[model samples]
Target chain A: MPSADEIFAGLMQGAREEAAELWEEAKEFSINTCWSLASQLVLVGQAFVAGEFTKAEVTKYLETIRLQFIATLAAALMKVEGLAERIVNAALTAVRDAINGALGFKLIV
Target chain B: MLRAIVVLLVVLVVSGCSSFQLGERYDKSLDDDLSAFQIEAVTFVASMRLNSGTPAGAFTSDAAKAFYPKASGTLSNIVVKAGLLSSRQCPINGIANSIGLPTIKIGGETIAADTPKTVVTGNCAVVTLLALQNVLADLEASHRDHQKIGPIRGQLAIDDINKAVATTLSGLRAKDL
Candidate 1:
Protein backbone atom coordinates (compact mmCIF):
# COMPACT_ATOMS: atom_id res chain seq x y z
CA MET A 1 0.00 0.00 0.00
CA PRO A 2 2.58 2.58 -1.06
CA SER A 3 1.36 6.20 -1.10
CA ALA A 4 1.15 8.21 -4.32
CA ASP A 5 4.47 9.95 -3.57
CA GLU A 6 6.08 6.59 -2.86
CA ILE A 7 4.92 5.20 -6.16
CA PHE A 8 6.23 8.26 -7.97
CA ALA A 9 9.54 7.92 -6.20
CA GLY A 10 9.72 4.27 -7.16
CA LEU A 11 9.19 5.15 -10.80
CA MET A 12 11.87 7.83 -10.67
CA GLN A 13 14.30 5.42 -9.05
CA GLY A 14 13.65 2.88 -11.76
CA ALA A 15 14.38 5.43 -14.46
CA ARG A 16 17.60 6.48 -12.78
CA GLU A 17 18.64 2.86 -12.47
CA GLU A 18 17.98 2.30 -16.12
CA ALA A 19 20.00 5.38 -17.03
CA ALA A 20 22.89 4.25 -14.89
CA GLU A 21 22.92 0.83 -16.50
CA LEU A 22 23.09 2.37 -19.96
CA TRP A 23 25.93 4.69 -18.97
CA GLU A 24 27.88 1.74 -17.64
CA GLU A 25 27.90 0.10 -21.06
CA ALA A 26 29.10 3.14 -22.99
CA LYS A 27 31.84 3.60 -20.43
CA GLU A 28 32.98 0.02 -20.89
CA PHE A 29 33.12 0.47 -24.64
CA SER A 30 35.34 3.51 -24.21
CA ILE A 31 37.69 1.66 -21.84
CA ASN A 32 37.97 -1.28 -24.18
CA THR A 33 38.83 1.20 -26.94
CA CYS A 34 41.68 2.73 -24.95
CA TRP A 35 43.07 -0.70 -24.11
CA SER A 36 42.71 -1.98 -27.63
CA LEU A 37 44.50 1.03 -29.10
CA ALA A 38 47.32 0.62 -26.62
CA SER A 39 47.60 -3.04 -27.46
CA GLN A 40 47.61 -2.41 -31.20
CA LEU A 41 50.32 0.18 -30.79
CA VAL A 42 52.46 -2.39 -29.02
CA LEU A 43 51.98 -4.86 -31.82
CA VAL A 44 53.02 -2.26 -34.38
CA GLY A 45 56.12 -1.62 -32.30
CA GLN A 46 56.90 -5.32 -32.23
CA ALA A 47 56.72 -5.42 -35.99
CA PHE A 48 59.06 -2.46 -36.27
CA VAL A 49 61.45 -3.96 -33.74
CA ALA A 50 61.57 -7.13 -35.80
CA GLY A 51 62.69 -5.13 -38.87
CA GLU A 52 59.52 -6.16 -40.55
CA PHE A 53 58.25 -2.73 -41.57
CA THR A 54 59.00 -0.75 -44.68
CA LYS A 55 58.37 2.97 -45.07
CA ALA A 56 54.95 2.24 -46.51
CA GLU A 57 54.43 -0.23 -43.70
CA VAL A 58 55.08 2.35 -40.99
CA THR A 59 52.76 4.86 -42.65
CA LYS A 60 50.03 2.26 -42.82
CA TYR A 61 50.51 1.40 -39.18
CA LEU A 62 50.19 5.02 -38.09
CA GLU A 63 47.10 5.42 -40.21
CA THR A 64 45.58 2.48 -38.38
CA ILE A 65 46.31 4.12 -35.04
CA ARG A 66 44.58 7.34 -36.03
CA LEU A 67 41.62 5.46 -37.45
CA GLN A 68 41.11 3.33 -34.33
CA PHE A 69 40.85 6.30 -31.99
CA ILE A 70 38.56 8.13 -34.38
CA ALA A 71 36.40 5.07 -34.91
CA THR A 72 36.14 4.14 -31.24
CA LEU A 73 35.07 7.58 -30.06
CA ALA A 74 32.84 8.11 -33.06
CA ALA A 75 31.12 4.77 -32.67
CA ALA A 76 30.45 5.46 -29.00
CA LEU A 77 28.36 8.45 -29.91
CA MET A 78 27.03 7.86 -33.42
CA LYS A 79 25.05 4.69 -32.46
CA VAL A 80 26.00 3.07 -35.79
CA GLU A 81 25.42 -0.34 -34.17
CA GLY A 82 26.78 -2.55 -31.38
CA LEU A 83 26.67 0.30 -28.81
CA ALA A 84 24.08 1.90 -26.58
CA GLU A 85 24.26 5.62 -27.36
CA ARG A 86 21.12 6.36 -25.39
CA ILE A 87 22.65 5.10 -22.16
CA VAL A 88 25.84 7.04 -22.72
CA ASN A 89 23.90 10.15 -23.55
CA ALA A 90 21.84 9.87 -20.37
CA ALA A 91 24.88 9.35 -18.15
CA LEU A 92 26.73 12.18 -19.81
CA THR A 93 23.82 14.54 -19.20
CA ALA A 94 24.16 13.86 -15.50
CA VAL A 95 27.88 14.63 -15.61
CA ARG A 96 27.31 17.83 -17.58
CA ASP A 97 24.90 19.12 -14.99
CA ALA A 98 27.27 18.25 -12.17
CA ILE A 99 30.14 19.85 -13.97
CA ASN A 100 28.05 22.91 -14.65
CA GLY A 101 27.17 23.15 -10.99
CA ALA A 102 30.69 22.63 -9.71
CA LEU A 103 32.44 24.50 -12.47
CA GLY A 104 29.84 27.26 -12.45
CA PHE A 105 28.66 27.65 -16.00
CA LYS A 106 25.56 29.35 -17.32
CA LEU A 107 24.04 26.33 -19.00
CA ILE A 108 21.16 26.92 -21.39
CA VAL A 109 18.68 24.49 -22.94
CA MET B 1 82.72 16.61 -68.04
CA LEU B 2 84.19 16.99 -64.52
CA ARG B 3 81.91 19.97 -63.74
CA ALA B 4 78.86 18.06 -64.92
CA ILE B 5 79.81 15.10 -62.68
CA VAL B 6 80.23 17.36 -59.64
CA VAL B 7 76.83 18.91 -60.26
CA LEU B 8 75.27 15.49 -60.59
CA LEU B 9 76.87 14.34 -57.32
CA VAL B 10 75.57 17.37 -55.52
CA VAL B 11 72.08 16.76 -56.81
CA LEU B 12 72.29 13.15 -55.73
CA VAL B 13 73.46 14.10 -52.25
CA VAL B 14 70.86 16.81 -51.81
CA SER B 15 67.96 14.67 -52.95
CA GLY B 16 68.97 11.79 -50.66
CA CYS B 17 68.59 14.00 -47.58
CA SER B 18 65.30 12.95 -45.93
CA SER B 19 65.38 15.80 -43.48
CA PHE B 20 65.23 18.29 -46.32
CA GLN B 21 62.23 16.64 -47.98
CA LEU B 22 60.13 15.56 -45.00
CA GLY B 23 57.89 17.62 -42.76
CA GLU B 24 59.67 19.28 -39.89
CA ARG B 25 58.16 17.49 -36.89
CA TYR B 26 59.46 19.01 -33.73
CA ASP B 27 59.07 17.58 -30.27
CA LYS B 28 56.26 20.08 -30.05
CA SER B 29 54.28 18.58 -32.97
CA LEU B 30 54.92 15.03 -31.82
CA ASP B 31 53.84 16.11 -28.38
CA ASP B 32 50.74 17.66 -29.90
CA ASP B 33 49.68 14.55 -31.81
CA LEU B 34 50.05 12.11 -28.92
CA SER B 35 48.34 14.45 -26.48
CA ALA B 36 45.42 14.69 -28.86
CA PHE B 37 45.19 10.92 -29.02
CA GLN B 38 45.46 10.46 -25.26
CA ILE B 39 42.84 13.08 -24.55
CA GLU B 40 40.57 11.41 -27.05
CA ALA B 41 41.11 8.03 -25.43
CA VAL B 42 40.66 9.18 -21.83
CA THR B 43 37.69 11.44 -22.34
CA PHE B 44 35.95 8.57 -24.04
CA VAL B 45 36.78 6.61 -20.91
CA ALA B 46 35.42 9.42 -18.76
CA SER B 47 31.92 9.00 -20.13
CA MET B 48 31.77 5.79 -18.14
CA ARG B 49 33.26 7.42 -15.09
CA LEU B 50 31.59 9.21 -12.19
CA ASN B 51 29.55 11.45 -14.41
CA SER B 52 26.10 11.95 -12.98
CA GLY B 53 25.25 14.99 -15.03
CA THR B 54 26.56 14.37 -18.51
CA PRO B 55 23.96 13.37 -21.10
CA ALA B 56 24.54 10.73 -23.74
CA GLY B 57 26.45 12.06 -26.79
CA ALA B 58 27.03 15.05 -24.60
CA PHE B 59 30.60 14.03 -24.04
CA THR B 60 31.46 15.66 -27.36
CA SER B 61 29.40 18.76 -26.76
CA ASP B 62 30.81 19.16 -23.29
CA ALA B 63 34.39 18.58 -24.31
CA ALA B 64 34.56 20.19 -27.73
CA LYS B 65 36.36 23.24 -26.49
CA ALA B 66 38.90 21.29 -24.49
CA PHE B 67 39.40 18.66 -27.13
CA TYR B 68 41.77 19.54 -29.98
CA PRO B 69 45.28 19.28 -31.42
CA LYS B 70 46.50 21.94 -29.04
CA ALA B 71 44.97 20.68 -25.79
CA SER B 72 46.53 17.21 -25.52
CA GLY B 73 50.18 18.17 -26.04
CA THR B 74 51.78 17.51 -22.67
CA LEU B 75 49.77 14.39 -21.92
CA SER B 76 50.91 12.87 -25.21
CA ASN B 77 54.54 13.53 -24.40
CA ILE B 78 54.20 11.60 -21.18
CA VAL B 79 52.38 8.72 -22.89
CA VAL B 80 54.99 8.28 -25.64
CA LYS B 81 57.78 8.22 -23.08
CA ALA B 82 55.90 5.60 -21.06
CA GLY B 83 55.45 3.02 -23.82
CA LEU B 84 51.76 2.76 -23.07
CA LEU B 85 50.64 3.96 -26.51
CA SER B 86 52.62 2.42 -29.36
CA SER B 87 50.54 2.29 -32.50
CA ARG B 88 50.89 5.66 -34.25
CA GLN B 89 53.93 5.52 -36.51
CA CYS B 90 55.72 7.46 -39.22
CA PRO B 91 56.54 6.15 -42.66
CA ILE B 92 60.18 6.44 -43.59
CA ASN B 93 61.84 5.52 -46.89
CA GLY B 94 58.80 3.34 -47.44
CA ILE B 95 58.86 1.60 -44.04
CA ALA B 96 56.56 1.80 -41.03
CA ASN B 97 58.20 3.21 -37.95
CA SER B 98 57.48 1.58 -34.59
CA ILE B 99 55.23 3.67 -32.36
CA GLY B 100 55.64 4.54 -28.67
CA LEU B 101 59.36 4.45 -29.23
CA PRO B 102 61.56 7.33 -28.08
CA THR B 103 63.39 9.31 -30.79
CA ILE B 104 65.38 12.51 -30.73
CA LYS B 105 65.39 14.10 -34.14
CA ILE B 106 68.25 16.54 -34.57
CA GLY B 107 67.76 16.57 -38.32
CA GLY B 108 64.08 16.13 -39.19
CA GLU B 109 62.78 19.66 -38.75
CA THR B 110 62.72 21.99 -41.73
CA ILE B 111 64.73 24.37 -39.61
CA ALA B 112 67.93 22.46 -39.88
CA ALA B 113 70.47 22.08 -37.12
CA ASP B 114 74.24 22.03 -37.60
CA THR B 115 74.12 18.26 -38.02
CA PRO B 116 74.20 16.08 -41.12
CA LYS B 117 70.90 15.68 -42.95
CA THR B 118 69.10 12.46 -42.00
CA VAL B 119 65.56 11.20 -41.54
CA VAL B 120 65.85 11.15 -37.78
CA THR B 121 63.21 8.95 -36.15
CA GLY B 122 62.06 7.97 -32.65
CA ASN B 123 60.56 9.91 -29.75
CA CYS B 124 57.64 10.58 -32.07
CA ALA B 125 53.96 11.09 -31.28
CA VAL B 126 53.32 7.38 -31.21
CA VAL B 127 56.06 6.96 -28.64
CA THR B 128 54.64 9.83 -26.68
CA LEU B 129 51.25 8.10 -26.64
CA LEU B 130 52.80 5.11 -24.85
CA ALA B 131 54.39 7.26 -22.20
CA LEU B 132 51.15 9.07 -21.56
CA GLN B 133 49.43 5.74 -21.02
CA ASN B 134 51.95 4.89 -18.31
CA VAL B 135 51.26 8.18 -16.61
CA LEU B 136 47.56 7.44 -16.78
CA ALA B 137 48.06 3.97 -15.34
CA ASP B 138 50.17 5.37 -12.56
CA LEU B 139 47.64 8.06 -11.91
CA GLU B 140 44.94 5.42 -11.80
CA ALA B 141 47.04 3.19 -9.55
CA SER B 142 47.92 5.93 -7.07
CA HIS B 143 44.44 7.39 -6.78
CA ARG B 144 42.79 4.23 -5.57
CA ASP B 145 40.16 6.21 -3.68
CA HIS B 146 39.67 9.29 -5.76
CA GLN B 147 36.38 10.42 -7.37
CA LYS B 148 38.06 11.00 -10.66
CA ILE B 149 36.94 9.32 -13.87
CA GLY B 150 37.06 5.51 -13.63
CA PRO B 151 38.40 3.15 -16.31
CA ILE B 152 35.38 3.50 -18.57
CA ARG B 153 32.95 5.61 -16.60
CA GLY B 154 34.18 9.10 -17.37
CA GLN B 155 32.64 11.30 -20.06
CA LEU B 156 35.33 11.33 -22.71
CA ALA B 157 35.02 14.47 -24.82
CA ILE B 158 35.74 12.74 -28.08
CA ASP B 159 32.75 13.27 -30.32
CA ASP B 160 33.18 16.98 -30.67
CA ILE B 161 36.85 16.62 -31.43
CA ASN B 162 36.35 13.77 -33.85
CA LYS B 163 33.61 15.49 -35.73
CA ALA B 164 35.71 18.54 -36.23
CA VAL B 165 38.60 16.42 -37.41
CA ALA B 166 36.43 14.26 -39.62
CA THR B 167 34.98 17.31 -41.29
CA THR B 168 38.41 18.67 -41.88
CA LEU B 169 39.63 15.36 -43.25
CA SER B 170 36.67 14.83 -45.46
CA GLY B 171 37.62 18.11 -47.02
CA LEU B 172 41.22 17.01 -47.34
CA ARG B 173 40.95 13.29 -48.15
CA ALA B 174 41.98 13.69 -51.76
CA LYS B 175 44.83 15.90 -50.65
CA ASP B 176 46.08 13.22 -48.25
CA LEU B 177 43.36 12.96 -45.67
Candidate 2:
Protein backbone atom coordinates (compact mmCIF):
# COMPACT_ATOMS: atom_id res chain seq x y z
CA MET A 1 0.00 0.00 0.00
CA PRO A 2 1.14 3.58 -0.62
CA SER A 3 2.33 5.55 2.38
CA ALA A 4 -0.05 8.00 4.07
CA ASP A 5 2.16 10.97 3.08
CA GLU A 6 1.88 10.07 -0.60
CA ILE A 7 -1.90 9.78 -0.35
CA PHE A 8 -2.17 13.19 1.34
CA ALA A 9 -0.01 14.84 -1.31
CA GLY A 10 -2.23 13.39 -4.03
CA LEU A 11 -5.41 14.49 -2.25
CA MET A 12 -4.17 18.04 -1.66
CA GLN A 13 -3.35 18.30 -5.34
CA GLY A 14 -6.93 17.33 -6.19
CA ALA A 15 -8.26 19.96 -3.78
CA ARG A 16 -6.02 22.58 -5.41
CA GLU A 17 -7.46 21.71 -8.82
CA GLU A 18 -11.00 22.01 -7.49
CA ALA A 19 -10.23 25.41 -6.02
CA ALA A 20 -8.87 26.61 -9.36
CA GLU A 21 -12.01 25.41 -11.09
CA LEU A 22 -14.15 27.33 -8.61
CA TRP A 23 -12.15 30.49 -9.24
CA GLU A 24 -12.73 30.20 -12.98
CA GLU A 25 -16.45 29.72 -12.44
CA ALA A 26 -16.59 32.76 -10.17
CA LYS A 27 -14.79 34.94 -12.71
CA GLU A 28 -17.05 33.88 -15.58
CA PHE A 29 -20.16 34.59 -13.58
CA SER A 30 -18.89 38.01 -12.52
CA ILE A 31 -18.04 39.00 -16.08
CA ASN A 32 -21.41 37.91 -17.48
CA THR A 33 -23.40 39.65 -14.77
CA CYS A 34 -21.47 42.87 -15.08
CA TRP A 35 -22.00 43.00 -18.83
CA SER A 36 -25.69 42.09 -18.63
CA LEU A 37 -26.50 44.58 -15.90
CA ALA A 38 -24.72 47.52 -17.54
CA SER A 39 -26.22 46.90 -20.95
CA GLN A 40 -29.74 46.35 -19.61
CA LEU A 41 -29.62 49.42 -17.41
CA VAL A 42 -28.47 51.53 -20.34
CA LEU A 43 -31.37 50.30 -22.42
CA VAL A 44 -33.80 51.09 -19.67
CA GLY A 45 -32.44 54.60 -19.46
CA GLN A 46 -32.59 55.13 -23.23
CA ALA A 47 -36.17 53.91 -23.33
CA PHE A 48 -37.13 56.31 -20.58
CA VAL A 49 -35.51 59.28 -22.37
CA ALA A 50 -37.33 58.37 -25.57
CA GLY A 51 -40.68 58.65 -23.73
CA GLU A 52 -41.37 54.96 -24.34
CA PHE A 53 -41.79 54.38 -20.59
CA THR A 54 -43.35 56.71 -18.05
CA LYS A 55 -41.45 58.00 -15.02
CA ALA A 56 -43.24 55.62 -12.72
CA GLU A 57 -42.71 52.74 -15.12
CA VAL A 58 -39.00 53.44 -15.40
CA THR A 59 -38.70 53.66 -11.61
CA LYS A 60 -40.42 50.35 -11.11
CA TYR A 61 -38.36 48.65 -13.76
CA LEU A 62 -35.11 49.95 -12.32
CA GLU A 63 -36.04 48.61 -8.91
CA THR A 64 -36.82 45.25 -10.44
CA ILE A 65 -33.48 45.20 -12.23
CA ARG A 66 -31.63 46.09 -9.04
CA LEU A 67 -33.33 43.28 -7.18
CA GLN A 68 -32.50 40.91 -9.99
CA PHE A 69 -28.85 41.87 -9.83
CA ILE A 70 -28.75 41.22 -6.10
CA ALA A 71 -30.41 37.87 -6.53
CA THR A 72 -28.01 36.84 -9.26
CA LEU A 73 -24.98 37.85 -7.23
CA ALA A 74 -26.29 35.98 -4.21
CA ALA A 75 -26.73 32.84 -6.27
CA ALA A 76 -23.17 33.09 -7.56
CA LEU A 77 -21.82 33.46 -4.05
CA MET A 78 -23.76 30.41 -2.89
CA LYS A 79 -22.33 28.36 -5.72
CA VAL A 80 -18.78 29.39 -4.97
CA GLU A 81 -19.18 28.66 -1.29
CA GLY A 82 -20.84 25.34 -2.02
CA LEU A 83 -17.94 24.32 -4.25
CA ALA A 84 -15.45 25.39 -1.58
CA GLU A 85 -17.23 23.26 0.98
CA ARG A 86 -17.10 20.29 -1.33
CA ILE A 87 -13.37 20.70 -1.78
CA VAL A 88 -12.85 20.76 1.98
CA ASN A 89 -14.97 17.68 2.57
CA ALA A 90 -13.32 15.78 -0.25
CA ALA A 91 -9.93 16.43 1.26
CA LEU A 92 -11.08 15.22 4.66
CA THR A 93 -12.62 12.08 3.22
CA ALA A 94 -9.44 11.39 1.32
CA VAL A 95 -7.51 11.69 4.57
CA ARG A 96 -9.83 9.24 6.26
CA ASP A 97 -9.51 6.77 3.41
CA ALA A 98 -5.77 6.99 3.47
CA ILE A 99 -5.63 6.21 7.16
CA ASN A 100 -7.99 3.27 6.71
CA GLY A 101 -5.94 1.96 3.81
CA ALA A 102 -2.70 2.30 5.71
CA LEU A 103 -4.20 0.28 8.56
CA GLY A 104 -5.26 -2.43 6.10
CA PHE A 105 -8.82 -1.96 7.35
CA LYS A 106 -11.53 0.67 7.72
CA LEU A 107 -10.07 2.20 10.85
CA ILE A 108 -11.25 5.73 10.16
CA VAL A 109 -14.80 5.02 9.14
CA MET B 1 0.52 -1.23 20.20
CA LEU B 2 -0.52 -0.68 16.55
CA ARG B 3 -4.16 -0.21 17.56
CA ALA B 4 -3.27 2.69 19.87
CA ILE B 5 -1.32 4.46 17.13
CA VAL B 6 -4.21 4.01 14.69
CA VAL B 7 -6.72 5.35 17.19
CA LEU B 8 -4.55 8.42 17.82
CA LEU B 9 -4.27 9.06 14.09
CA VAL B 10 -8.06 8.73 13.60
CA VAL B 11 -8.75 11.10 16.51
CA LEU B 12 -6.38 13.69 15.12
CA VAL B 13 -7.96 13.52 11.68
CA VAL B 14 -11.57 13.74 12.87
CA SER B 15 -10.95 16.62 15.22
CA GLY B 16 -9.10 18.57 12.57
CA CYS B 17 -11.87 18.02 10.04
CA SER B 18 -14.96 18.65 12.18
CA SER B 19 -14.48 22.38 12.80
CA PHE B 20 -14.55 23.31 9.10
CA GLN B 21 -18.28 22.70 8.63
CA LEU B 22 -18.84 25.07 5.70
CA GLY B 23 -22.40 25.30 4.35
CA GLU B 24 -25.76 23.66 4.89
CA ARG B 25 -26.07 20.02 3.90
CA TYR B 26 -28.19 19.07 0.93
CA ASP B 27 -31.91 18.61 1.59
CA LYS B 28 -33.83 16.54 -0.92
CA SER B 29 -37.08 18.36 -0.17
CA LEU B 30 -35.58 21.79 -0.81
CA ASP B 31 -34.22 20.58 -4.08
CA ASP B 32 -37.63 19.24 -5.14
CA ASP B 33 -39.41 22.42 -4.06
CA LEU B 34 -37.02 24.60 -6.07
CA SER B 35 -37.37 22.45 -9.16
CA ALA B 36 -41.14 22.55 -8.95
CA PHE B 37 -41.13 26.29 -8.37
CA GLN B 38 -38.82 26.87 -11.33
CA ILE B 39 -41.17 24.99 -13.66
CA GLU B 40 -44.22 26.88 -12.45
CA ALA B 41 -42.46 30.23 -12.64
CA VAL B 42 -41.05 29.64 -16.10
CA THR B 43 -44.44 28.49 -17.37
CA PHE B 44 -46.12 31.56 -15.93
CA VAL B 45 -43.62 33.86 -17.59
CA ALA B 46 -44.01 32.06 -20.90
CA SER B 47 -47.77 32.43 -20.66
CA MET B 48 -47.30 36.13 -20.14
CA ARG B 49 -45.12 36.24 -23.21
CA LEU B 50 -47.71 34.42 -25.29
CA ASN B 51 -50.45 36.80 -24.19
CA SER B 52 -48.43 39.98 -24.15
CA GLY B 53 -50.26 43.25 -24.87
CA THR B 54 -53.59 41.61 -24.04
CA PRO B 55 -56.07 41.81 -21.17
CA ALA B 56 -55.69 38.08 -20.61
CA GLY B 57 -52.26 38.71 -19.09
CA ALA B 58 -53.20 41.84 -17.16
CA PHE B 59 -52.26 41.80 -13.49
CA THR B 60 -55.79 42.79 -12.50
CA SER B 61 -57.39 40.14 -14.68
CA ASP B 62 -58.87 37.04 -13.09
CA ALA B 63 -56.35 34.82 -14.89
CA ALA B 64 -53.42 36.58 -13.21
CA LYS B 65 -55.13 36.78 -9.81
CA ALA B 66 -55.69 33.02 -9.82
CA PHE B 67 -51.96 32.36 -9.83
CA TYR B 68 -51.07 34.66 -6.97
CA PRO B 69 -52.25 32.66 -4.00
CA LYS B 70 -50.68 29.32 -4.88
CA ALA B 71 -47.45 30.86 -6.09
CA SER B 72 -47.02 32.94 -2.98
CA GLY B 73 -47.77 29.92 -0.81
CA THR B 74 -45.11 27.80 -2.48
CA LEU B 75 -42.57 30.61 -2.20
CA SER B 76 -43.29 31.11 1.47
CA ASN B 77 -42.96 27.38 2.07
CA ILE B 78 -39.52 27.41 0.41
CA VAL B 79 -38.35 30.39 2.43
CA VAL B 80 -39.44 28.89 5.73
CA LYS B 81 -37.97 25.48 5.01
CA ALA B 82 -34.64 27.02 3.99
CA GLY B 83 -34.55 29.07 7.17
CA LEU B 84 -35.15 26.01 9.29
CA LEU B 85 -32.26 24.21 7.63
CA SER B 86 -29.73 27.03 8.02
CA SER B 87 -27.53 27.91 10.95
CA ARG B 88 -28.23 31.11 12.88
CA GLN B 89 -25.13 32.62 11.26
CA CYS B 90 -23.86 31.75 7.78
CA PRO B 91 -20.35 32.33 6.42
CA ILE B 92 -21.58 33.74 3.12
CA ASN B 93 -22.76 36.87 4.89
CA GLY B 94 -19.29 37.60 6.15
CA ILE B 95 -17.72 37.04 2.76
CA ALA B 96 -20.26 39.33 1.11
CA ASN B 97 -19.73 42.04 3.67
CA SER B 98 -15.98 41.81 3.16
CA ILE B 99 -16.39 42.20 -0.60
CA GLY B 100 -18.55 45.32 -0.23
CA LEU B 101 -18.96 47.66 -3.17
CA PRO B 102 -16.50 50.42 -3.96
CA THR B 103 -17.69 53.92 -4.78
CA ILE B 104 -17.86 54.87 -8.45
CA LYS B 105 -17.23 58.15 -10.26
CA ILE B 106 -19.54 59.21 -13.07
CA GLY B 107 -18.95 62.47 -15.02
CA GLY B 108 -16.69 63.74 -12.24
CA GLU B 109 -19.49 63.07 -9.74
CA THR B 110 -18.77 60.64 -6.96
CA ILE B 111 -21.65 58.25 -6.41
CA ALA B 112 -21.26 56.21 -3.27
CA ALA B 113 -22.01 52.54 -3.82
CA ASP B 114 -24.51 50.80 -1.63
CA THR B 115 -23.12 48.50 1.05
CA PRO B 116 -22.92 44.81 0.24
CA LYS B 117 -25.64 43.52 2.49
CA THR B 118 -26.88 41.17 -0.21
CA VAL B 119 -26.12 37.70 1.11
CA VAL B 120 -27.38 37.02 4.65
CA THR B 121 -26.51 33.37 5.02
CA GLY B 122 -24.16 30.58 4.02
CA ASN B 123 -27.13 28.31 3.31
CA CYS B 124 -27.38 28.09 -0.49
CA ALA B 125 -31.08 27.19 -0.29
CA VAL B 126 -31.98 30.19 1.87
CA VAL B 127 -29.87 32.56 -0.22
CA THR B 128 -31.51 31.33 -3.40
CA LEU B 129 -35.13 31.17 -2.19
CA LEU B 130 -35.05 34.68 -0.73
CA ALA B 131 -33.70 36.08 -3.99
CA LEU B 132 -36.43 34.18 -5.86
CA GLN B 133 -39.02 35.80 -3.59
CA ASN B 134 -37.64 39.21 -4.49
CA VAL B 135 -37.78 38.39 -8.22
CA LEU B 136 -41.41 37.33 -7.82
CA ALA B 137 -42.11 40.56 -6.01
CA ASP B 138 -40.60 42.47 -8.89
CA LEU B 139 -42.75 40.57 -11.37
CA GLU B 140 -45.88 41.33 -9.40
CA ALA B 141 -44.92 44.98 -9.05
CA SER B 142 -44.22 45.35 -12.74
CA HIS B 143 -47.43 43.63 -13.72
CA ARG B 144 -49.41 45.86 -11.40
CA ASP B 145 -47.68 48.99 -12.66
CA HIS B 146 -47.75 48.28 -16.39
CA GLN B 147 -51.20 46.59 -16.44
CA LYS B 148 -49.91 44.06 -19.01
CA ILE B 149 -46.68 42.22 -19.59
CA GLY B 150 -44.68 43.10 -22.68
CA PRO B 151 -42.94 40.41 -24.69
CA ILE B 152 -39.37 41.62 -24.18
CA ARG B 153 -39.79 42.24 -20.46
CA GLY B 154 -41.45 38.89 -20.00
CA GLN B 155 -38.50 37.20 -21.69
CA LEU B 156 -36.05 39.13 -19.54
CA ALA B 157 -37.88 38.24 -16.36
CA ILE B 158 -37.82 34.59 -17.29
CA ASP B 159 -34.11 34.76 -17.91
CA ASP B 160 -33.38 36.54 -14.63
CA ILE B 161 -35.41 34.23 -12.43
CA ASN B 162 -34.24 31.12 -14.24
CA LYS B 163 -30.58 32.04 -13.88
CA ALA B 164 -31.01 32.75 -10.17
CA VAL B 165 -32.66 29.40 -9.46
CA ALA B 166 -30.47 27.34 -11.77
CA THR B 167 -27.16 28.44 -10.24
CA THR B 168 -28.21 27.61 -6.71
CA LEU B 169 -29.61 24.27 -7.75
CA SER B 170 -26.24 23.48 -9.27
CA GLY B 171 -24.67 24.35 -5.94
CA LEU B 172 -27.09 22.24 -3.93
CA ARG B 173 -26.44 19.28 -6.18
CA ALA B 174 -22.73 19.41 -5.31
CA LYS B 175 -21.41 15.94 -4.53
CA ASP B 176 -21.89 15.19 -0.83
CA LEU B 177 -19.15 12.57 -0.44
Using TM-score, give the best candidate's number.
Answer: 2
The CAPRI class of candidate 1 is incorrect
Show pairs that collide, candidate 2. Answer: none
Q: What is the Å distance of residue B113 in model 1 from its true position?
A: 21
Please write out the lDDT profile of model 2 over residues B1-177, one tens digit for every residue.
867755654575767654234455667898899889889888987897687678888887787897777889998987788777656554445554455443322234344433233445535556655556766876787778777767656766676677667756765665232
Residue by residue across A6-78, what tens digits does model 1's lDDT show?
Answer: 4345545554565586756555554444444443434334433444332333343343344334333322222
Candidate 2 local lDDT, A24-89, one digit each (tens) = 645555555555655454444444444434455544454444445544555555566667766655
Give, for candidate 2 chain B, the lowest lDDT window spanning 10 residues: B100-109
Candidate 1: regions farther than 4 A off: A1-27, A80-109, B1-177
Most lDDT-accurate candidate: 2
